[model samples]
Target: MLRISQYSSVSSQQSEQQYVPLKHVSVETFIKFFAADVTIKQVFRNDETKPIEAVYCFPIEEQAAIYSFIARIDDRELIAQLKEKNETQREYSDALEQGHGAYLLEQDEKSQDNFIINVGALPAGKECHISISYVSELDLVENGSRIRFVVPTTIAPRYNPNTGDVSSPAGTTSKYVQTAPYTIEFRCQLEPLKWLEKHPPRKGRVRQIFLLTDGEISNVNEVLDLCRSMATSTRIFSFGLGHSPSRSLVKGLARATNGCFVFIPPNTSVDIHVGEQLQKALQSYISGIQVDWNLGTTVMSTPTRIPPVYANDRLIVYALANDP
Candidate 1:
C-alpha cells in the first residue's frame, strides 16, 4: 500500500468523512459499481490479488462489462460468503463498516440490496474521524478495535464493477448464476481483454476488423485506411516498432484508418531530441480530439502509446501521458 498522508482534521463524523492522506479524505462522488483490469499476478491459489480483481473469466471481451467500486463496514468472511452465493458477484470477503471503508462493494440496485449495513467512523484518542476513499463503495479495515482503513502501499482483495457477472440480476436464485437473453457489454483494450480471455472481442456490440495483409501492415497509411473504412463503430488500429521506422506509414495510416498512429521510442537507445519531438506530434494529434488540450503551451506529461479501448462497436486508444 502507498503511504497515505493528508487527511484533514477535516470531518469529525463518518457521513462527512473523506479520503485522508495521514488522516481523512472525503468519499464524496467516489461511489462505484465495479472495476476491471488486465494484469494478473496471482501470489496464491486462494489468496486474492489486488492488481487484478477478476470476478469472472469472460470467454470473450464482448462478454465482459465494467462497473464501479463500493465501500462499507462488515464481516470479511461474511462478505466472501455472500459473493460466493451471489453469482452476479465474483467473490467478496471481509472489511471493517465499523468495516465499511475497508471493503469496496458495488452500488447497482440489484446487488446493493443484498448488502444491508450501516457504517460510521472510528475514534482516535477518544475522538472519532470519518473515512473517505476513491472507490465507489468501501468498508473500514479492523484489526481488533483499531481502524487501519487506508493502506496505500499495500492492497488487499477489492471489488471492481466494470465487468459483468455470469448471471443476470433478475434471475431466480436457482438459475441466478446463469446469463439469460440479457447482458450489457463494452469492449476492453486489446491487452487487457487478452489478459481476461485468450481471444479478442466478438459478437454482441463488438465490431470485428479484419486485416487482409498476409504480414503485419508495415505502412501506417495502409493500417490507418483499414481501421478507418473497416473499423466502423469498432475499428482496428495497427502499428509496428521492430524492423522498419516509417513516418509516412504512420501519417497515412492515421489519415486513412479511424484510429491514431503511435510510435514507441527505443527503450535503451532513443535519442532525447527525437523522443521529445515524437511526444509533441502525439500530443498534437490527441489534442485534435479534446478541444481544450494545449499541445505545446505548457510543460505537460508527454503522450505515450495507449492500448485500445473496445466497446460494442468501437476500439478506442487512450494515449496516456506516461510509459508502460
Candidate 2:
C-alpha cells in the first residue's frame, strides 16, 4: 500500500497545493518452505508547474526484514545505506539547499510498522522510481498444517482532534484535484520440498479465520452457535469496523470460539490493532488450558472451559462469587 502527499509550507493555503501522483506499482513474491521473499516497485510523477517535494508513506509486516532499497531518476541510480538519523537528515537538507535531487527514507516516529520517504527537488514532468525488497517467515495456520501470507493494500482514515474531523496526511488528493489512474501488477511463485510432500495438508480444515465487517448480520444467534460448535477445531478473530457494526454479534462470535474481538471506531486506523493480532496468531499456543480457583466452593466462572493461551499474550478470566 502507498500514501502520497506533496511537501509544502504551513502558510500555503489548501487550495493552492498540488500532490505527486502514483503512476505504476509492481509486486512479486517467492515462497520456499517456511520463508517468503517479497519485492515491490513503484513509480511516481510530478505534473505540477513548479518543482515539488513528494512524501510517501507505506506499511510492511512487523516481522519482515528489509534488505534492499534503490531509487532511479532518469540516468542516475542510487542505493540506500544505513546511517545515523540526524546525520542523514543534515545531508538531505544540504542537498536540497544546493539545488540537487535528494531521497531520504526512514521509519515513522509513531509507528514501527510504517515507513516514510521524502523525494526532494523533483522538477515538473520528471519521474522517480523506487524499489524495495524484504524477507519474512510465513505464519502457520490450520493447526500448524498450512502457511499464510498477507499483503496489506489500504490504510484506513484517521481522526484529527484539532480539526474535529477525519483527515489523511499522506493522501494523494488535494481539495480541488484528484489523483490520476494507476496500474498494479502482482505475481507469486511457490516451491514444494520433499519434506512438505510427505506431510500433506488436510483439506476442509480451517483452524483460524480473521473476520472484518462493517455491516450487521441478521442471523446472529445462528452464527454464534456455529462458531461455538467449532470451538475445539477453529479459532475466530473478529473485527467490527465503523459505527454501524453490531457489537453483540461481533463479540459473541469471538467469545463462542474462544478467540478475540476488536472494535474499530469511525475514522480510525486498524494497522496497530491488526498487527498485534497477527503477532499473537503466529506465536505458540498452550492448549487444554485449565484454571483452578481456591477461593471457595461458591465461586463460579463465566467460561467454564478455558481457551488456548498464546505465548506472551495477556489472558483475562471473569468470575462471580455467590457470597462475599
Candidate 3:
C-alpha cells in the first residue's frame, strides 16, 4: 500500500535510537482532460499495513468534500442506485463509451435530459484507484441569452453558477438566460446572432473561429486585425462583458468577418433558460441564430431585424423590449 509522505525519510541515534517514516512524498502523475470529461487517478504503494490515498492535483477542498460525501454510504448500494437513476433520467439519452476509466456523453437527438445529481455516480471505494466522470452538458464559454453548446452532453448538466451555463447562485431560469463570468448589455452588441451563424466556424474559403472577449481592449479593429493576422480564415464571436466602450467597432469586426457580437451585462444575476437550445447548438451545430423582429405590437413600421434570439425549447420569447 502507498502512503502520503509529508517529509523525507528520517532517523536519529544517540544514547537511544529513534526512526520515523516520511510524511509527504512527491509523486507525479501525467493527466489528460478530454473535451468535456473528468479523470481521476490514485497512487498506491506495496504496504499491507496502512491505506493509500488518491492525491488530487487541484482544489484540495473540493476533493475532500467529494470524498466525504462518498464515505457516508455503502459503495455497492450507491452504484446500484446511480445506475437506476441514470436509466430513468432523461438528460443522459446518448452516452459515449470510452475505456473502463472513462466515458463520454454521446450527442444524440434526445440530448436534453438532466443527469441525476445526488446519486454520486463517480464514487470511489475506500483506498481504491478512483476515476469518476458524469456529464457536464454546457461548455460554450460564451456570454448572452443564447449561448449554445457545439458539443452535446451525455447527461443533463445543471445551469449552475459554478457550471458556467447559468447566471445565478442557484441555477434557476432557462430562457433569455444569460450567464458569463462577466456581462455585456444587449444595446452594445453588433452583427446580430444570425449573421454570425451563417459565417461561423469560418466563412468563405476561410475557416471561422470563435473569439472570446475579456473586456480589456479598446480597439476592435486592432483586435480583429491582430487575431486575423495570426489566422485570417476564421472570425471571432466577441463576448462583451466588462467595458463596452468600443462596442460599435466590435460590432463592425463581427460584420467584417460575417460574425456577430453579444453582450453579457454585469447586472444580471439569474438563469432563466436552457433546453432545446442545448441540442440546437450540439446537433444542429448552429452556434446561434438571429431572432427575427416582427412588430407584433401596435407599431408595424419596424422591419425584421436580427436580435439575440434566446434559445429555450421551453419558452421562446424574443425579448421584453427590442431596439437595434
TM-score of every prediction relative to native: 0.18, 0.51, 0.22
By TM-score, the better pick of 2 and 3 is: 2
Instruction: List RMSD in Å for every model shown.
Output: 22.2, 17.1, 20.7
User: Over the stretch 55-121, how does candidate 3's per-residue lDDT look in tens digits?
Assistant: 1211110101122111112233222123343453333222111111111121111111111121111
Off by over 4 Å in 1: 5-10, 13-101, 105-257, 266-324
Number of colliding residue pairs in model 1: 92
lDDT leaderboard ranking:
2, 3, 1
Q: Per-residue lDDT tens digits of candidate 2, residues 1-324?
A: 233335333313342444444799888999997778999898998877666667677766543678988999999999999888878877876776666778888865433445667787777788999998988766554335567775644333321122322122322223322232444221111122123334334666546668776523334455566567657666678887864454455666676776766667677788876876677666777767666677776878746766666654444556788774
lDDT of 1 by residue, 1-324 (tens): 111111122222111111212223332232232222321111111111111111111111111222323332222221212243454222222222122222233332322112211221222222122232222112211211321221122111212234343321211111112222435242212343234234434555533232211112222232334344433345333332432233333333333434433344335343443343344333323223322344444333322333232121122333333323
Worst 10 residues of 1 by lDDT: 41-50
For model 2, the run of ten residues with the poorest summed lDDT:
184-193
The candidate scoring highest on lDDT is 2
Off by over 4 Å in 2: 1-15, 159-324
Superposition error at 128 for model 3 (Å): 17
| Local lDDT at 103 for model 2 | 85
Q: Model 1 — TM-score against the truth?
A: 0.18
